[model samples]
Target chain A: MTFFGLFLLFFKIGVFTFGGGYAMIPLFFDELVTGRGLLTQPEFANLLSLAQMTPGPVGMNAATYAGFRQLGVWGAVAGTLGVMAPSLTLVLLVGIFMNRFQTNTYVRAVLDGIRPGTIGLVAAAVIFFAESSILRAPLQSLWTGEGKFGISLFGAAAFCFTFMVSKYLKWNILWIFLVTGSVGAALGYWGLI
Target chain B: MKQFQRLWPLCWEFGKISAVTVGGGVAMIPLIEEAFVDKRKFLSEEEMLDVVAVTQSVPGIIAVNMAVLTGYRAAGIAGAFAAAAGAAVPPFAAIVLVAAFFAGLGGNRAVDGMFLGVRSAVTALIFLAAIKLYRQTIKTKFSFLVAVTAFVLLGIFRVDAVSVILGAGVVGVVWMLLCRRKQKESGGGQ
Candidate 1:
């Protein structure tokens, strides 16, 4: 896609995205991974992790990085501008008409509806990342009789370990990444993965 | 000149906050509270709470939204742009540098394995975020149904996420209108 196409794609993603950065994942997956075939699943997964680990909004990070990967620095600018454009415009409008919009029943109803839906969207994003990271293949592969259906033992272990620690131990996410990444590199050194 | 003078501080405050915070937009909340409310005293506590409410209400990245509202309050429209640029540019630059670095390191086994592990961890993080959001938003039966339907549509049916979101909003409005009509009918009968 051309730079303008990239900008428009991200702008659309920005307009629909609710909740937060995590909520944007499924949208990114659908538009970029499935629809456009611009990014592979693994590449998308990596982008998610990198976006999380980096500074600033995950949505912006993902957009800029993904755009950079697709085109160049200019692509990054396009994607960043595209994603932020909606927010800048909408927020300014809201700011100007804050009193009326604040008490608007229709706005509340739409938000209430959208809020729960975002949970589902984020959950779907989990499945998307799981297929790329933990599972050897997409879950559909089992029923479709395509591609090997299995789990990467290392990946599963890392996933569970990270989940439990973050849930119970309240370990910081970045520390978890550092520890798991180190172990993974060591394992790779021994040709385990 | 006065508005231009306010712009730098707004940009610097948001820029520093965004540059240092990891784990995305939500993680920056406390720091933003500290910078704007506690430290700078630019926004009162109540105003900050309102900022949070408005930011979450709007679509798109939460950090940028927060920056826009807070900056608008601080220095009008120009302040909003300055703060947003501050919030967005650091991540943009940082990710660009990291992406370029990784691209150069392509096919390196160690890097691949590290990402493999990190990717798995990322999945777990996203799952936790979903659970947290579920706890926050999914309270009533209608909400539960909406969540389930959205999950099934997007995950199983592979429907476009944008469509599901818009459809859910439409569903919500219709549900609310129907409930109101039912109340009106019942009251009239009484």
Candidate 2:
């Protein structure tokens, strides 16, 4: 895609993303993976993990990394600007007409619908990440009975462990990533995974 | 000149915050509050809350939105640009550097394994985020319906997510209006 097209794609992603970074994932998968075929599922999942590890907004980090991979530094610039444009424009407008916009019934109604929808989108993102991350093959293989139903037991264990710690213990996210990554590396060195 | 003077400080403050915070935009909230409201005295407490509300309400990355709004309050439009640039540049530089490093390291088993683990952990994080959002967003039956419908369309049917989001909004408006109409009719009958 042209640089402008890249910008426009992210601009649309930015506009549709209501809740936050994770909310952008499903849209990112749809537009870049399925629609344009710019990134494979594994590549997308890898980028997301890197985005999470990095310091900044996950959406911005993902956009920058994806754009850089696709083009270069200029592509990164295009993606960043595209994602920020909507916020700059809309914030300015809201700043000017603050009270009315806050009180507007239509605005409230739209958000009411959009908020719940965002939950579903994030839920879908979980499956998208899981397909590419933990599962050795696509879950669809089970339904079609095409390839063997394979998985990385270590990866599944890591996922469950990570989920419990993050959900209940509230462990620092960066630490969790570092520890898991090191374990994976060591295990791989031993041919365990 | 006065606006320009505020630009660097605005940029520097936001850049500092973006450079350190992890997880995502929401994670940066307390630090932002600390920098602007408590330390620098740039905005009052009430104003900070307003900024948070507005940033969360609008569609975009929340970190950039917070920077723009707070920077505008500090200086002007130019300050907004300055803050946004500050907020954006660190991650851009960091990711570009990391991407370049990894690009050259292809076919390395160790790096591959590291990512494999990292990706699994990332999936778990996304799942946690979804659970938290479900608690926050799913309150009423209508909302539950919208959430379920959106999930089935996107997850199962492979329908595009953008259309599902927009469709949900239309459904919300119609449902709300119909409820209001029913209330009015009952009042008239009484």
Candidate 3:
């Protein structure tokens, strides 16, 4: 796609995105992974992890990574700008009309509806990740040499560990990434899964 | 001129927060609160909460929205752009470098395995985010139902998310209006 197309695509995603970056994952799956075929399922999984790994909003990180993968540095620039545009415009509008609409029933009602739906969108994202990152997609490949067992025991351990720590300790998320990523790297280096 | 003085510091504060923050928008909030409310005394704790609520409600990355609102509160529109740029640029540059490294490392076996672990952790984080939002937003029976239906539709049925969100918006408005009407009628009867 052209740079303008990249920008427009992200702008659309930005405008439509509700709740947060995680909630936008399904749209990304549909538009980029499934529809445009910009990246394979595995690559998309890598993008999600990378987006989480790196600093920035997952939405922006995904846009930048996708753009770079597609068309180099300029693509990244276009993608970032595209994603930011809607927020720039809308935040300004919200700031301008903050008092007028703060108590408006219609706006509040729409958001109330959206709040619950966002939960669903995020849960859907979890399933999407399960398919690509855990299940390794295209289930038929499971019986063939193409798809090794997608769910690793170590990965599950890490998930459970992080979930518990996050729930109870409320540690800064960066520490979780640092510790888990280090352990993961050490395991991989040793070829220990 | 006075605005420029406040603008630079506001930019610098958020820039620092953005630089260190990871795992996406919501994670930066506490740091934002620490800087704006505690260190700078630019806003009260209550105002910070309002900013968080508004930013969360808006259709953007909450980090960016928070920057825009906080910046505006501190130093008007110019400060808003300054803070947004400060918040955005550091991560942009950092991710660009990371993208380069990842592109170069695509075939490395160790990297692949490491990412496998990272992806799992990321999945866990996503689940945590969902639970956090669910607790904060899902207060009523209907809200819970909408959450479940949306999850089923999107996850199982593979329905488009945009449609689900909009449909939920309609559901929310109608449900709210009906509840209000019933309350009004009950009060009139009394």
Candidate 4:
């Protein structure tokens, strides 16, 4: 697709998705991987992990990285702007009108309702990430019932270890990522899998 | 001059935040609260919570949404753009550089190994985010049910997230209206 087409596509994605950037993963994977054939699963996985490691929002980072890969600097700009346009437009309207309707019952109700729904979407994202992170050959296993069914023991261990540290220890997450990532690399270097 | 002084610093503050914060908006909330509420005193804690609510309700990245909302409150449209741009600039530059570096690596073995670990941890981060949000949103049994059902539908069944979100909104509005009506009827009749 052309850069303008990419912009419109991201614009639609930005407007329709709720529950923040993670919630958009399913759609993003579908559009970029399945629909457009822009990125392979492994490349997308790398992009996702890198997107998290760097700053800014995942959605924006993904757009920038993917766009750059697709077209270069202009693709990056268009992709970023397209993803941002919907929020920019909506926040302005909400800013102007929210005070007046701040206490309105229906407004409150919708917001209230949307909150939990966001959780569910994030939960979906967890599974989405698992497809790349925890499982091996996720899409292939879905079709052929091959390598995807079982969790990679190492990945599961990493996930469980991270969860425990995050929930129980309350260490700074940045340090957690750094330490766990290093350990993983060492293990890999040693052929530990 | 005063406005410029105020807006520029606020923009820079968010820029600092964008540069440091990793793992997306979920990880950034505490940093945002610390900067905007504790250090800067630009927003009270309650106001910050409200910002969370409004930002969550809208579409887009929560970090950017927070920046826009908080910036607009601080200044106006220019402030909004400034904050948004400030927050965006660091990541834009960083991702490009990282991608360029990775492009040269040609799937280096050690690097890919490290990323494999990073991906699992990132999944854990996402799971943690859901747990944190669950505390806020899952108040009553109905909401609990809604959340669980939404999870099942989207996560397991692979239903469209947008459809589930919109559906839950409709259900919540109708549920609340019904409860309110029943309360009024019971009290008024008595």
Q: List each candidate's DockQ score.
A: 0.84, 0.78, 0.61, 0.61
Per-residue lDDT of model 4, residues A146-178, tens digit only: 773767787888899989998899867678778
Q: Give the whole-model CA lDDT for all candidates, comma-separated.
A: 0.89, 0.86, 0.82, 0.79
Q: Please, what are the lDDT tens digits per residue for candidate 1 over residues B29-115?
A: 798899878987878998888888888888988888989999998789999999998898789889989998887875778888898
User: What are the per-residue Cα lDDT tens digits for candidate 2 across A1-193?
Assistant: 6799889988999988888899899899999899989999988998888888888899999999888888888888888888888888887778767779888888888888888998989989988888876787777787888877788887898899899888889899988998889998888777777
TM-score rank order: 1, 2, 3, 4
Q: Write the per-residue lDDT of candidate 4 for residues B65-178, one digit (tens) a residue.
A: 888888776677777888888888898999888877777765666776787788888789888988887997688998888889988987667676567778988988998999
Cα lDDT tens digits, model 1, A106-159, are 998888899999999999998899998899899788788899999999999999
Please list all clashing residue pairs in model 4, or write none if there are none: none
User: What tens-digit string does per-residue lDDT give for candidate 3 at A1-193?
Assistant: 9999999988888877887789989888888987789988778988878887777778878888888887788888887888877767897788778877678999999988988899999988887776654565544455555755566677788888888888899877767877777787788888897
Off by over 4 Å in 1: none
Residue A107: error of model 2 in Å?
1.0
How many residue pairs clash per model?
A: 0, 0, 0, 0
TM-score of chain B, per candidate?
A: 0.95, 0.93, 0.90, 0.81
Residue range B10-119, candidate 3, lDDT tens digits: 98998898777776687788898889888988889987887877887788777788888898878888988888888778777877888888888876667867777777
- Per-model interface RMSD values are 0.9, 1.2, 2.1, 2.2
Worst 10 residues of 2 chain A by lDDT: A132-141
lDDT of 1 at A32: 91
